[model samples]
Target: MAKPLNLLELIPKRIAKWEEVEGLVVILKPKFSHPWMREHLLPRLKKPYYRVKLDETGSSVWRLCDGQRTVEEIGKILSQNFGEKIEPLYERLSYFFQMLERNRFLNLTQKDQSSGQ
Candidate 1:
């Protein structure tokens, strides 16, 4: 029997952010309260932690998470947007999705079918 499709196996299209540091775009999810924030804030407020060091492809994948697109949808978008006709789009997307999942940056949540909010 064929393996069931795991929605969580797809790349996250949300909760991902990226910023360029030293010419390399670092992708990460910012924490709401970082441990080190107490030292920097005048009132000792907690800062969010940031996970950095994402590659160019990872960064690209992160940008596609607009809440409306799914893994299959993203593959199509990437292929069309980047003009990647020769290469396999789904395979590449799956690779990046796996990487993001391993890093704990992407969270898989059930899609709300009703109201589509």
Candidate 2:
């Protein structure tokens, strides 16, 4: 029988890809709200379409999430690349993944993720 997957193993891929603009990698922020708000409040707010901009580290991680590497593998790469700069690696990485998942940014491969909040 196969062993059940852990949290890290469950998050084995990212399907939300980013586009490169000049030297920066960016994802377009989708506007979601009532049509009235979109036609009214959004224009007045003047929010940029590409709201979430990844920094150097985030961009690196985003690139590494190519649907084959597990979260642990990504963590190892981060450790090697960043060295001692990012302490408590798993916590930070997990939180980052969770944030991405929460914001509907990451497309994880977990079976139940579709119904997740």
Candidate 3:
């Protein structure tokens, strides 16, 4: 049986490529699921992909999830950058990550609980 995942040890990685638009993170979600459709039909539309604009904190989290940093490390960085404004940090981070995962925006890997990142 598999062990339960530790929130701190989970590493988040972005699945979709993103860009900075006016200092905010804008994720591009492909409109078509199949490659053939994307190639043959996507170009016909004015907008190729869905542009998901993230808020300041979400943008910061999105930028940090480069497949390297663990959730704990991200929380530490956010705490340092946002201070009290990000009170109740871990809970919010967990929710944010869950939502991202549910929406297929990012993927999470469970780091060994005994290992140090």
Q: For residues 3-111, what per-residue lDDT tens digits would candidate 2 score against the true structure?
A: 6756576454554546776666686664645677667766776552545777877777788877767788888999999988877888888888888877777766644
Q: Per-residue lDDT for 101 in model 3?
A: 92
Q: Give a tens-digit lDDT track for model 1, residues 1-117.
A: 986766533435555556677656676554544546534652443434465775655556676666666777666766776775526777676676777777666754446659663
Off by over 4 Å in 2: 1-5, 15-17, 33-48, 110-117
Among these predictions, the greatest lDDT belongs to: 3
Pick by lDDT: 1 or 2, better one? 2
Q: What TM-score do all the candidates reach, one by one?
A: 0.58, 0.67, 0.88
- Candidate 1 segments whose C-alpha is farther than 4 A from its true place: 1-3, 6-11, 21-24, 29-51
**Against the true structure, whose TM-score is highest?**
3
Q: lDDT (CA) for every model shown?
A: 0.61, 0.71, 0.92
RMSD of each: 5.4, 6.1, 2.2
Task: Report the CA-based lDDT of candidate 2 relative to the real structure.
Answer: 0.71
Candidate 3 stretches with Cα past 4 Å from truth are 112-117
For candidate 3, write residues 42-117 as lDDT tens digits.
Answer: 9999988899999999999999999999999999999999999997999999999999898789999987457654
Sort by lDDT, top down from the best: 3, 2, 1
